[model samples]
Target: MKTPSAFYKPLAIGAPEPFREIPVSLERMIHFVPPHIEKMRAKVPDLIEKVDVVLGNLEDAIPADAKSDARNGFIQMARDNDFGSTGLWTRVNCLNSPWFLDDIVEIVGAVGEKLDVVMLPKVEGPWDIHYLDQLLAQLEAKDGLSKPILIHAILETAEGVKNVEQIAAASPRMHGMSLGPADLAASRGMKTTRVGGGHPDYAVLSDADDGGARAAYQQDLWHYTVGKMVDACLSYGIKPFYGPFGDFSDPAACESQFRNAFLMGCLGAWSLHPTQIGIAKKVFSPDAGEVEFARKILEAMPDGTGAVMIDGKMQDDATWKQAKVIFDLAKLVASKDADMAVIYGF
Candidate 1:
């Protein structure tokens, strides 16, 4: 079969990300704060210390009447605070919304230099990302910004999910993708109203006649889409993130959803509330015991190409590759946290 037309064709006006000696990508918690709410902004200093990324909302979480204030507040907060290692991102209004135009212009023009990522919601296809790419370029020039702002396309529509590969490879300015399960459910006309978690009705059940008791098996509504999204992002050397889990009180379910994403090759998942922050971070970070085992495997196989015997188990090139991933991430996390440094034995 022929590859999709968009494959191997990157958009104009963007450059591929340069490789660094120690590549650092935030695959943990992304904390969301609504700029329209003063309480949220007031928590930034504390939140920044805890979360890897703190994204200010100018989109769905903000009311239509309060969009202007949200936009202004988002930019002002960026100007007011120093983000340090914590990335400051803003989820702008969708392209179709009236507020989006102002959002793209004012935010990028004012705080573009200070911002790390600009999230575009309800992105239907590559065209939506292209629109933002061109607009940001022009704004960068107009504002004389030193660095171009990065784009985070939210996959929340059927069309967007279908064309995810194209969207991921659209531009070098493309930071990564986030799965927006809520809007995606609406776009697909799903029966469930819950945001991002499995619904009981949308599950498997035991056979009535053969079984003594009927059981309902909950499944991830987004398994297929997320699987495809992760593959697409990895192919393009970009990141894939799982969006919010609204059942904040059910810590078990939230952690389960996040673990599913992490196991399925997602870099991280979004935290809609402070309650979910620890869950996301813990799930995304490689396990301490797992990391130790990986290090042992690496230490035994100093030569990464050959097969070896360790603890009565055969280790080979494939195992080495997997261990390398864990070791790299362990080192990366250790660089950021003193406790992690001690845990990782750095």
Candidate 2:
């Protein structure tokens, strides 16, 4: 079958380049409460300072009757305060819902100036992104906005997982794709009861003494999806992020999950609870020791010349490139946290 005009673009080859000049670390999703606006407002001052991105969630957890108030609260918050370099984002109602059009109209018309990104949930293919892209462009043009508002897709459906590459390449406004474990589990009819993460039922055990062992249980429910999503984003020159670590109480498990993504080249992970914010920041940012070592590699290499040995490992042009990634991330973290420079010895 012939590819649609929207999906006919050549496949993106090789590793993806970072999409944005600055790093984005979305603040843990905020649940809206009409009566708690004052409380939420009080928390914003501190939250914005610590997080690279603050997102006001308009779907899922918010009460149906309170959507308007929550939308208004975000507008008021954006108007009343200056977030400095921190990016302000929002998760709009899904396209299939009655509230989505209003969500887009109100958010765009009201605070389009301040918003940096619009997170679209349960995106199935490039068509969904294309519709949103055109609407956003029209809105921005009408509002006299200079910068185009970017879009982030939530990969949470069977078709979405299959067509992730096309969706990532759908528009220039596409920023990144996040692994939404909960909805994806439901859509795929996964057997796990947990949102996303490891399951006890998915494990392995050894047979009796001297007997041969066999492959046993299932592994990470989202690993295959995450790996594919990450590859898609990398191929298309966009960022890949781990959506949410829903277990709020287990900080250790959260760290492990975030670390897995970090090692796999994810830019960042979502923080649903305030406690997870520090863990995400700590795991995602390059460690102080690694940062210092990366600086040494650059100093030694100087002009990207010949290879050398560092910590019993071969250090060459390829190693230098790898080190630079760490150095750049450290620099970004330092820019956000003045104290980070001192802490990381940058």
Candidate 3:
């Protein structure tokens, strides 16, 4: 464990000082772009407007031969576009992969200044974060960068899940974590091929009644994992996100899964397809009615203390905090979207 005196110190001489607090940004969806493809790279400028975080993915989907191309493409994408408030991120190859070293080196050397976050995949523990944190500091010092690039871990392996709390508190450069359900399923030897969402066979049947047909209601396979990740992240003051829902054909299911994560305290989710982008934005943003009610709560209890009667229900300090959550989120959504601002009466 790092001592309090050294926790915020730069790992390398002349490296920028570590951040005391993670920068606040409205990240509703991390839209993945396969940077190895030229056509996909062309869409990044427009994508910057639609998505909160535009991630150039150089890992899983890229062919082995195209790893270098993907890395180079991400650098070019970072250089050519000015992302403004929208985050520019990249999902580099995992630590175990041969391409991982070059992916970090070249991208940082070329466009470290514009890059917002580096999404590290399959991190098993705090050791992975420590390694990256030290390396980033060295690289940042060498490149004369002004700010530290944040590390976002992907919880894929079973060991990663087990060591999640430690990982969240691993470094001052830690931005957040995303739940990688497909790889996590494989790591845990779960009997399912789906990337995310609930499994049909993993359902519970209702009580049998006098020879009548029993109903089977499907449960989310990821609830426990998401809850665990959320708690660890919230405890450490980092964000938690839902990973990709691979079934592009089923928009309803994707919305449902995203909504569950949002209700459970996730700030965002991954969007692999263009259609899912809209769904993520809609699900992650606070509802208009809820925002209005939250506004009322704040008005009634200016200091967020004592009990008040609203709609025949008793509200105390607990409910005031709940209302603040919705109101704060609604304000963030309003900042980017003019329509939302009007609808939310912001």
Candidate 4:
């Protein structure tokens, strides 16, 4: 275990000190852009206005031959756009991949000042975070960057799930974690080929009725894992996010999965398609009615102490905390969206 005194110290000489608290931002959707494609890069300016985050994808989806091109393209994108309040992040190739080193070195060297987070894929343990943390510090020091770049891990491997708590506490650089269901499925030898969302096979049957058909209700395949991940992240004061939903044709399922994660304490989710962006914004943002109720709760319990009746339903300290969560999220949404501000009556 790291000594408390040294925990926040810079890992490399001249590196910026790690953040004590994760920066406040409304990250309802992390919109991914395939940096290797020119036409896609052209859409960045417009994309910046829509999404909370713009991530240059340098890993999985990029062709192996275009690794260098992707890196260069991400740099170009970073240089081209102002991004303003929208987070600028990139999903670098995994630690074990050949492109990993160059991805970090080139991206950091060229646009370290503009970069917000480095989304590290296939992280198995704290050791992975530690290595990246130290290396990032070194690069930040070398480039004379003012702020330390944050690390975001993908909880994809079985080993990653096992060591998630340690990984969340690995360093102050941890921005958060994302559940990479497709890769995690392969890691655990799960039978599902789907990227995310529920499976029909993983369902519960209603109690048998005489001469009647048994009803099967599908259960969320990711509930347990997402719960575990959310607990770890919230415990460590870092955010948790839901990853991709592969079936673009099924918008209803995507919205359901995103809503589940949001209710389970995830601050955001990845938007893999244009259609998913609206879904993420709608699902992650607190409902105006809920926010209004939360506001009423706060008004009733000004000190967040003692019990009170809200619409004839009793609320106490525990419920006060829940109300605060919604109110806080609604405030963040209000800041970013003028329409939301009007609707939320902020």
Model 2 error, position 162 (Å):
0.3
What clash pairs does model 4 have? none
Task: List lDDT for all candidates, in order.
Answer: 0.83, 0.77, 0.95, 0.96
Off by over 4 Å in 3: none
lDDT-superior candidate, 1 or 4 = 4
**Candidate 3, lDDT over the whole model:** 0.95
lDDT of 1 at 19: 24
Task: Kindly list the per-residue Cα lDDT of model 3 for residues 1-346, writing each as its tens digit.
Answer: 9999999999999899988999989999999999989999999999988999999999998999999999999999999999999999999999999999999999999999999899999999999999999999999999999999999999999999999999999999999999999999999999999999988998899999999999999999999999999999999999999999999999999999999999999999999999999999999999999998998999999999999999998888999999999999999999997888998987
Error of 2 at 321 (Å): 2.0
Tell me which of candidates 2 and 4 scores higher on TM-score: 4
Which digits, one per residue and each the tens of the lDDT, describe model 4 over residues 103-167? 99999999999999999999999999999999999999999999999999999999999999999
With a 3 Å backbone cut-off (N, CA, C), the pairs that clash in candidate 1 are none
lDDT leader: 4
Tens digits of lDDT, candidate 1, 1-346: 1155543233333423222211355648888898988887898989878888989988887778999999888987898899888888999889998988999889877888888788999988888987887777777777667665788899999999889999987776778999999999999999878888788777888789765788889888989999999999989888899998988789998898889988898878888888898888788878888898899899988889888887788999999999998888888777666677787787
RMSD of 1: 3.5
**lDDT (tens digit, per residue) of candidate 2 on 264-286:** 87888777778877888788788
RMSD in Å for all candidates = 3.5, 5.5, 0.6, 0.6
